[model samples]
Target: RKQLLAREMGLEPPATVELQESDKEIDPLQVSVLSVSSFIAQMRTVVGDGEATESARAQAARQLVRLAEAGVPGADPEQWWATQTVAEERPLNNKPRLSPSRIEALLKCPLNAMLKDTADNNSDKYHLVRGNLAHAYMEALGRGADEELARRETVEAFEKIQTSPTWKRAQERDEFEQLLVRTNQWIQETRGVLELVDVEVRVDVESEPGVRITGYMDRLERAVGEGGEEGGLRVIDLKTGSSKPSDEETSAHPQLMAYQLVLAHGELQQEGGLTKVVSSSQGEERDGATLVYPGTDTKKIGTADQARKGDEELAEFAALLPPLLDELAGPRVTARISPECDRCPLKPICPVQAEGKVTTDVNA
Candidate 1:
């Protein structure tokens, strides 16, 4: 009908298209567009053929299985097989380090966490850039940078970052500047509570032998008691996003809990160079952990019981790591689809998503 209409409009009929034969040679890149299952099915034919040698057939079958298990789009089965084989044979003396954020990510979806480590999909979205700038400004303030210098440096740093290709398309430049101003104002307003401010301090605690939990504390403050004695340690995490603390989120807040555990174990003071300052103030206990959202009326403070619960949860998670690592090291790793799949970069090729098992609403 479209051809007839075109002819009536004084145009020649479109040329008839010829379909390529199914057995015709195809570009390797084009073959990458095939679904993992379809590709595996095709590979199976070669593996089952009597003409192929036993060793060659076995190798092809192994490659097919690896590709199916990877569940990532456009991943080269042969390359993945070779790389995984080499990695499997390597001596893994170095223990895997778990940060609070990484722990949270793993809990949401193990496959997502694994892909985050291996994928090169780093983002410089508005929120991420603003958060980073906020952190830098807070770090400078904590490190004793005069308010004026800190403000100037933060703006300069952000300006330099704006020139980079990573942030070339960053939106909301004015909003980011306002955020900096508000952050500086917050620093000034909270100076009384932030008597001893340590910024970007590295805290490492070995939950168990050969298993370590490591992270950087954005701000660690030494609070003063009513009687002028050392009150205790306060771990404050800055947030630039819209997420507020809820009973559910705070109850299992891995980051805050990790900070509490580190402080409870006295590792934050001992290993993080806080011993001198902390000891000088007579070695006070942990007061609590707070998530501070500057420029917003949102502050989530975890109770003492919540912090202790976090310690227990961390231990339990550590105990489960060996088995989880063993499973991931094997040829096949199961994907447990959840609401998190909506944001997962691998969802495009995820077998579970392909099968329509993923939920659409993250809140649901």
Candidate 2:
């Protein structure tokens, strides 16, 4: 403090005081200033994937165009936008590769699926943090990190991610000890029977031309069948949510089925077509999927979903893709009112709920 005061007063500093230069690395706490390109990128996101009116996220198309016209370098609005007739026109991606959960959503209620952001939203920070930490912890474990190290890393990551709003919402989260405990429980649930082959497996399989199923399995494991026989590839999907879907629901789970489909047909995009590493470890047979919930079952492990040998179900799921693709290629989307609609954020403004019909015009 005395040294700083002397320096400020233009007085000679103490001999012991030494100045230090900082390295190129910016502190994580430092808020990043947006460059022109970054501004253009964010503006592109707002105009592209942002909600119909937002959280009221009306697309920022005009702003994007303005940026481009105003000579902002690399500001290509067209690249971000779906092919549209003109500015401010909302057009769907003619061929978007979808996740399995999205396929389920499309099956349940097209309107709700189309309207709701299936991925994380602004207010869902708590779930996002919890899920991320849990996955990271498990992933570390899969990569052979000991219990203590994984726990410490997860807790530290959670603390670093906490902001005022996140802290408030995450009050129920017990300093991530509970999440780590859940992670341990999930690891135990594996029972040493399922050999961990890989973590974070990415797959992009074409159900049909221009219609593809894209998803990431949490982990891939080799299971042992009855009587000590070596089993085929089993996909493990980790869930951090409290709500446990029933066995029947698991059997028909579009997401689980989709992962199975990936096992059967999808290429492991990261590995350049599931090279000898994946192919050698995981034999041809699709041993199906298991939903590992590492959050709710703290006292005792829950009866998690295990959907096996989904060939018939996979066929049915694939069969529906063609018709769904047909719908996507067209302008209008029909909403099949189901339980899923109950959770749609657009329910209040949805035309189906208001006028008993499917229409993008929320006010109508």
Best by lDDT: 2
What do the candidate models score in CA lDDT, each in turn?
A: 0.59, 0.64
Candidate 2, residue 66: the lDDT equals: 67
Q: Any runs in candidate 1 off by more than 4 Å, and if so which?
A: 1-93, 117-129, 163-171, 268-284, 295-334, 355-364
Q: Across residues 1-364, which tens digit of lDDT does each residue of candidate 1 receive?
A: 3354335334456776665797466667435334665655445555667996676566666666666577645335444322333335543433456665566666666667776445434453534665787898878777777877777777766666564465543554555666666666665666665565577877666555554556788777777765667666878777776556786777667677766656755433454454322111122367667676554533432222234344456566456555545434544445677877776667755656743323322221
Clashing pairs in 1: none
How displaced is residue 63 in candidate 2, in Å? 33
lDDT of prediction 1? 0.59
lDDT for each residue of candidate 2 in 1-364, tens digit (9 for 90 to 100):
4354335334455666444566445576433345876656555555556354442123355666666788777576444323423333344665667776577777777766776665436657766776778888878887778888788778777777665566463664463668677767766777557777778666666655566766667788888766667777788878777678987888777778777766666433335534222212232576778886656645775545555655676777778776666555545667676766666676765656863323334232
Model 1 residue 144 lDDT score: 70
Where in model 2 is the C-alpha error above 4 Å?
A: 1-91, 118-121, 162-171, 189-191, 226-228, 266-283, 327-330, 355-364
